[model samples]
Target chain A: MNDPEIKRRGLMLVLSSPSGAGKTTLSRLLLADDPNITMSVSATTRKPRPGEEEGVDYYFLSTEDFGLKVNRGEFLEHAKVFDNYYGTPRGPVEEALSDGRDVLFDIDWQGTQQLMESAEDDLVRVFILPPSGQELEMRLKKRAQDPPEVVASRMAKASDEISHYTDYDYIIVNEDVDMSLARLKSILTAERLKRKRQVGLSNFVRGLQQAL
Target chain B: MNDPEIKRRGLMLVLSSPSGAGKTTLSRLLLADDPNITMSVSATTRKPRPGEEEGVDYYFLSTEDFGLKVNRGEFLEHAKVFDNYYGTPRGPVEEALSDGRDVLFDIDWQGTQQLMESAEDDLVRVFILPPSGQELEMRLKKRAQDPPEVVASRMAKASDEISHYTDYDYIIVNEDVDMSLARLKSILTAERLKRKRQVGLSNFVRGLQQAL
Candidate 1:
């Protein structure tokens, strides 16, 4: 239903959630379903895992190179997690936005806050929550990659992360993945229809008025 | 899925468009499909048409009663169109909103401005436009109730109405009815998920935190 004549600036869709809250699954689903959106590739100082490709999985960089990019102010939002530094590169996302393509960010609250500071108008922040504490613990433990002590530590971190739910524009208590995905798609659809985002609307309306 | 534990305050969905922009058709379709939203019945001084029922089609009132309601500040918005007066009663709408039921208004730009003054936070205004000036004229002429002279006058009035498109929150160029209806539903769904509209979210989050 989009009018070809009316050009729109794309929005920054940031989905933040605690670990094991189904954010990754939802993000993957949305990317596969929507043609207009692309996942944001982050630059990280962490070593790449096996089968992880450069630029596709992440922009793997040494500490010096990452520091240089940070000094150059090339990242939209950056943070240090444990001993590794990770940040979203600013150039590609800006290019996508101007060309009317959305960039999706699967980041935490701190990264979302940084994006808000830089591009408040373009950002649509949605926080995802587990149905209950018990559910969250179960999901965390079900991932057998982590031991019990790791799961306990992750739960503590999840508590801190979920505390920032009020900072988001929309909160989804993700009881079911499909329902949450539908709501996320609805948010994207509605935000695209916003009057301010349609950059060429004034010219189109002006042309209509002149024709009348 | 809606969580019963987290209550939400309803939104005021105002749809404004020119006479032949398919707003009325879209409104009817939305009302028939969505059980959660109801039309905002206005109180008017005009005599009821055949089969028009009181408190359903309209709350037909005398000029004196309408004037009294206006003087008492009972109307959320009241306006005199030609010789007759029409208004939205604040009491019923407020009751519905507090009960988590949405009210849809098929009013013009003037009435929408008044609604914005009274309930800016609650209002989600959408303005529809025809695909072109020629299409708008064709649609107006297709309605056989109006004569050619009336159609010409409506075209003039439509030009005026179309100028207010920038004042709306969302703008839809109505190329097809089904597409427009889908966009309308997305807007409602997204607005319902807004953080400010979710009234009981804080307590729900607090409960989750305590459980954690």
Candidate 2:
């Protein structure tokens, strides 16, 4: 099924969902299940927390170095959340792509837009939605990451995020976790088959023409 | 997971390929495995062959009836191939769609373009590509349906068909039948999850807001 003989360019599998819609969980499942894909390690100016590896975790960078790379157009999309700068470096991603491994993106709609603008053909966007508002609120409340007031604001933000649903190539109403994971895998499988991503196709077609 | 409660709109899963690329085989696999999809039946001016059941195989029509339907704009896409008229009838497809059943189209690029123009959002086009020109010609010759001259013309036509690779949303290289079928099913699975196709999403979202 992997089609080892034919080389394929990697895809930027961008996954965007509201705080409680379980996109992070889906990303983890995809990474664990598929050997052909890996997490897109981000470059960050913020200090790495304990139990984090340098290359394996975040590519921890000095603030000055991060800013310089941003200026040099090395980062695909850079953003300042509060004081810390987090960005995706384009070089490693491109290298991985040519090496026939896909890079998974866990980002919001804004980062997806930037990626699309830069590499429209390389990107596939999927937006996850909770089956119901009640279910969404219930999940958020269960997470207990924020206070009630914060949860209210998070719900508002979720609506704002869901408004951009049309912008994504696919949407999954994640009612059941297992089913959602299956759908995500299917998307990845199908995206790998895109003609533009298969760099060996033109040559292969020509070879077919010559064979007969 | 089939969300039965949500009356989802069906997708027009169009599979296109150059002659001898095995789209028909793939389509059969898809239909046999999935009960949610059915073949798109066409109305034609040409008489049906032996064992061709009306309504199941095709909607048989007289020349006058075909012309009247054409004038009434009943066809999704129609072409005058040689002297006979063949076209996909719109009503049955739409009815099947609203009833939560998908319609599959096995066609070439020209018909796909017409479907895209008329219902871009509803149609999901996947092009099947042979693994190699060598493989393509070998498959054609193996079929033994045409003479050498006919095969040469078909090979030329295949080259012309492959040129329109960029037009398709997805492409599957039929290097292995099982893998290619898996990719095709994956495409259908993902396309079914599109937010626009899930007509009940807005109402579900609104319900979520109200529950909050």
Candidate 3:
């Protein structure tokens, strides 16, 4: 009794979190669990490591090419980090969206802000937080053998990131990884059912109306 | 390491559908499964049916009382059907929302429109549809021993109701009850975590910032 398959316009799901808030783990689980969504590949000028594959890990570009792409506005959002350039390519994300495949982005708040300006309607921003400041600091300490000053500096940066929670549409506190993952799945599922995203819904409904 | 429990502002979840479209079944399943949401009780001028309890089923009211409440703007929405008046009392729903308990409404499109006008920020509207027009007709016929004219009338009404799908935030086609219920639960869970509904998030974030 179901109608013909409805077409959907995909969304850009941005996950922004502090260094120790478990965003990467949740994103990995989501990609593994949901086949409809793919991780967004960024273009980077940084030299790829031995195991990293071009186009899969990143679109490895030369410095001059990266600057040219930026000037041509090919990147949806780009930034210079240390000496390397990194940006989300506008072409593939738009292509995936038009084909009804969601793109997941693991980006910082600044990158998310840039995407917001370029593609507000297509974006769903979620800000993840650690269970507590103390827990975040502990995770940072345990992750590396960095000295106290380095750990302190990371904590300050995390605090700065956490301050931008208000800028996001949804916020998840990473109390338990499993619970947070479940919440993330729910958010994605719900957002996909949003009226605006279902591109063929009007035609489907109109068909029913005519059938009656 | 989790922060203190944050307060929330509850939402009004309105589910609307035409007759025999599985709305009642889905609503019943949702209420039985979820503890945080409760069915909204309406005040009615109609006499109670057999075994229907006051306040639990409805707040039975006299016609005069209903009129007075309407005059005072106490009802969120009101309507007259046949010889009786029916309305959603604004007081209890408001009280529940302020206490972080979601109120579920099995309303028609008109009632949903009123809620949108009166409480836009608190409202989350979902429109449910039968999987197909033929299925809807079959369900309506199977439910009763009605004649052809009655069935035809119902089909027309369903068509009219389905036309308002654009007015809803989410749409779910009832292909299977279990799947539809799952989608409803996801919508509820996701809407609860929206940033605007989490009232104490600012303070919680501030505490994290200060600790760092």
Candidate 4:
């Protein structure tokens, strides 16, 4: 048996946030601070964007290849968004989790639901919300890349996204960056301790019983 | 309405561990580190040990008073151990939670179940385990307060307690003191983020629709 002190594979951590709510940034911070976690790179049918590489940004595939995988039920979770098929391939994520690593997903609510339905036992969901409506609008406006109408559309869409906050296992208000990040860190740390996630704990307890 | 940024009330954190697993120490560190939390002093028919106080150590109720509270259903949860009745008083804990103060309960598995059944929405249960049987025995031996036979008895009872580990929402292996304390801290922090616990998130989102 492995060392009792060492934790075995952990559950998948799915974080969903509104367009500008900082989930991507939080994911980067977690990966930088903790070595035991890896982001689950999705497989997509869409062509790679500029400077994006296969296997790094995503497992870029043709529509036919993505369709084949979908037919074979190979993906743990998948969805079509904006004319592109995006999916969490079951193989890599399972391998990562079995090796005691946490897999992070930055996806929308639809993807989260699929992941939960497929592997509810191995998933923890967190939703991030902008602290206030005015702040949310301001953040969208500051992007400056989007047209005013697009900003208005996004602001309108954000309300719908925020309405589903209760569907998440955890909801964090993105009021202060540092504080929000700290709260996310604590959630990760605590989720790791969940009885269901710690596979070694059951064996360890049994060993303790026999020794006593 | 109150500020949406403010959390409605603090949570009730229940830390359950087998005898000799150092839960008391963990609870103390959590309280010392978190200003928002309060230790929930339970009422008990058991007499105070050396250096313990009434109300502070426990409510120290007479049998009649304890029975009266139980009869009136004034306790959130209660159980009998070794012929003495111990219970968490409803009034104090409810007041504390409503006022945005977290409460800590260093209780047993049975008491944990009762509290969970009663105030599941408000409770986060964590079970702590000693690293191993040998390590647990070593720690018990170090305490030097109990005789060998008594220690053996306690150890024998530990397995039954640990069997219920899965009942808890979280579990921690207490190998290193500081690390376990950090794990407990993470649990408290993350539990505060549970979507169900946040009262105003839905209304806040609904209000945002108007701004949109």
Candidate 5:
């Protein structure tokens, strides 16, 4: 809205929440409201769906190519599950950052960890939390009413995700969608102004010094 | 204006700038706009001005009493300059912090460094930069067309202040006052959400986990 671009490098705004905690909805609202940020398109070994575009949806990759890229450390972070590999490639993220346009990441806690390992300072992690466990279960049940054991496993997974909440830079308890989105926007606004993220900072400081 | 009370510990928002960079104006605007935050009333050995009240303006102190308090580790950070003592007390700050009421600090880089040493995690440092050296000088001249050497000394002091700009967690170039205040508000909002600052967070997390 302000559109005050001082020519700074962007951040990896990693949003991680348990499946029913409204992470996707929050991400959508953020991208819709702000033109300065863009979703980070990831590469995947799985075949693209019919409607999905190559760059728009996913950078669809062959298993061999994925493996080769992993070997070369081209991906910022990657994971292997079942028969396919999915990872955020380093190239496009770096390109977006240097252009002073932020990249939004909708990744799990493990992926967030990997990103942090690779690029610690560039990443701003915000963990989304459900208001209550009952609300979380209700949302999950609406999606699918599974057997007791399955429900137990889902709870276990949610617990696992919640355990990593402290690993994030900020936390947003999703009591209301609008409020959560507003908080996310505030976090983004604040992170953008961090001194290290401003690529033009050194030069800007130098100019100020010369005038003094 | 939105007094959404999700009780949490507050942060020490330290604002530093060179003399001509408009720190006082930004501080006054922020204080006027936000009721949830209050100025960090410092303890001083200097005499209070005519309109100033004892506790509200400053906790007026004698030289001996100030030295005793310093010895007792009561002040978070304090300094002596030209026979006058000024310090932020640890007790009052801690009380305000636990009650979810933020404290604003308008201090120089030296005071900031001392505060950082004592309460590193609780502090958020923001440095305001003037638009240009020329602008800074013009403002200084307007304040008083002092001798050339005095002007030179002021510029040198400003340069020293600017050199520590990198030491802050965030930087705001005061090109526009309203924009800078908006940015400051955003920073405060985001900082309030950090899990560590939210003392009730563990209980909040527990409640969520139990529902799952």
Candidate 6:
């Protein structure tokens, strides 16, 4: 038989950053542009914001339900923030990965660590940083979602978050949207081709030898 | 003073395969295409082949000289193949990596193991396989340098080499040259962006807070 088709185990890519660092935008762009990659929808106890859909943007769950799932080990990674619990559902992410798809995580440093510790071999973590403190403040203020004081608090938190950048597997400086996106694409493309991911390679070669 | 440009260590990528599997060709392509990657030239006691230049190809060394260097722990990795001694020099490779360049090793399985044991954190191993045994035979035969008997013997040896495929991090089937090249390029590009390799990411992000 032709060497069995090399099927790769799915990969978990964590993109971590402080609030307003453009991870969400980059994740959206990645999903839209790459068919091989799929975004991992999270489960949250937090109330849905305007125009949010259950199971699409997130698995909107009650606090009790969220707590129950967490207890059942149904989360790949989980964290508490702003008086609400948020987590990556175990089922969907596992399904997507086993099907040879790449999953993106737009999460915090804690979530990144949790997933990595649990699945170090499959996890690729990237920490994104704003180009400059001034730019970070500009981006946060531009959002118009937060008041000046809240924005300042986020800026303060950013310094703390950036301190952990070395813990990630890769880092990207979001100086320009296009450039950062390009770099991200290159990284994903290259990672997809890693030898460990190409299980079919050996069998493919065997087939070639048989044919020859 | 900013982070002193904290030079990180270099990575060692070992590409191994049976003769005629295009390991050498792929290594050359990778070296020529990537300015940041340098080939780890082996110091050999064997005489140079036609068209081979000293230093550019192998660092021609006497057997006694090679033995002395090996005794002194001068080689990062080395081996004796076919009654001739061959080994990768230590200084140049280390220097290249300290300067942020990646080094490629075109060595066999034994040398690959030594590298893994010596510099496990910095090593990425790739194995190239012929698409089929028949294809392997054809490739061996097509190399006008060898006779039919030699081709058959090489083909016999290929099976033994291929049995160790599981030890590799990535495997490539030499089905089509261009496609394989594309795959190879992707692997290198992805590896270059690995989180562990970006030594200054943390400090860089910390610096960004100034912009805020």
Best by TM-score: 3
Flag regions of model 6 displaced more than 4 Å: A1-4, A47-50, A145-148, A198-212, B1-8, B48-51, B145-148, B209-212
Please, what are the lDDT tens digits per residue for candidate 1 over residues B1-212? 36788899988999999988899999999999999999999999999999999999999999999999999999999999899999999999999999899999999999999998999999999999888878887888898787778888888899999999988999999998999999999999999998898898888877766766
Off by over 4 Å in 1: A145-147, B145-149
**Candidate 4 docking band:** medium
The sequence of per-residue lDDT tens digits that candidate 6 reaches over residues B1-212 is 01234345567888899888888888888788878788888899999999999988989999899999999999988877789988888888878877787888887888888887777878888888876677677777888787668766777777777777777887777777777777777667666666677676556655676665
Give me the runs in candidate 4 sitting further than 4 Å from their true place. Answer: A1-6, B1-4, B46-54, B145-147
Residue A187 miss distance in model 2 (angstroms): 0.7
What DockQ class does candidate 2 belong to? Answer: medium
Q: What TM-score would every model get versus the actual structure? A: 0.96, 0.90, 0.97, 0.92, 0.94, 0.88
The lDDT leader among the candidates is 1
Q: Model 5 over residues B135-180: C-alpha lDDT tens digits?
A: 9999887878799999999999998889999889999998889999
Model 2 residue B186 lDDT? 89
lDDT of 3 by residue, B1-212 (tens): 12247788889999999888899999999999998899999999999999999999999999999999999999999899999899999999999999899999999999999989999999999999887778888898999999999889988888888888889999888888999999999999889888899898988888777878
lDDT of 1 by residue, A64-115 (tens): 9999999999999999999999999999999999999999999999998999
**Predicted complex 1: CAPRI docking category:** medium
For each model, chain A TM-score?
0.94, 0.96, 0.97, 0.93, 0.93, 0.87
| lDDT (Cα, tens digit) per residue for candidate 6, span A163-202 | 7776787777776777778778767765665667665665
Error of 5 at B130 (Å): 0.8
Error of 5 at A74 (Å): 1.1
User: Which of 5 and 6 is the better model by TM-score?
Assistant: 5
Q: What is the iRMS for every candidate structure?
A: 1.2, 2.3, 1.5, 1.9, 2.2, 3.8
Of the candidates numbered 3 and 6, which has the greater DockQ value? Answer: 3
Candidate 5, overall lDDT? Answer: 0.89
* Model 5 agreement with the true structure over A17-76: per-residue lDDT tens digits: 999999999999999999989999989999888899999999999999999999999999
Provide the clashing-pair count of each candidate structure: 0, 4, 0, 1, 0, 22
In candidate 4, how many Å is residue B56 off?
2.4
- The fnat of each candidate, in order, is 0.66, 0.68, 0.77, 0.86, 0.85, 0.63
lDDT of 3 by residue, A104-136 (tens): 999998998999999999999998988777888
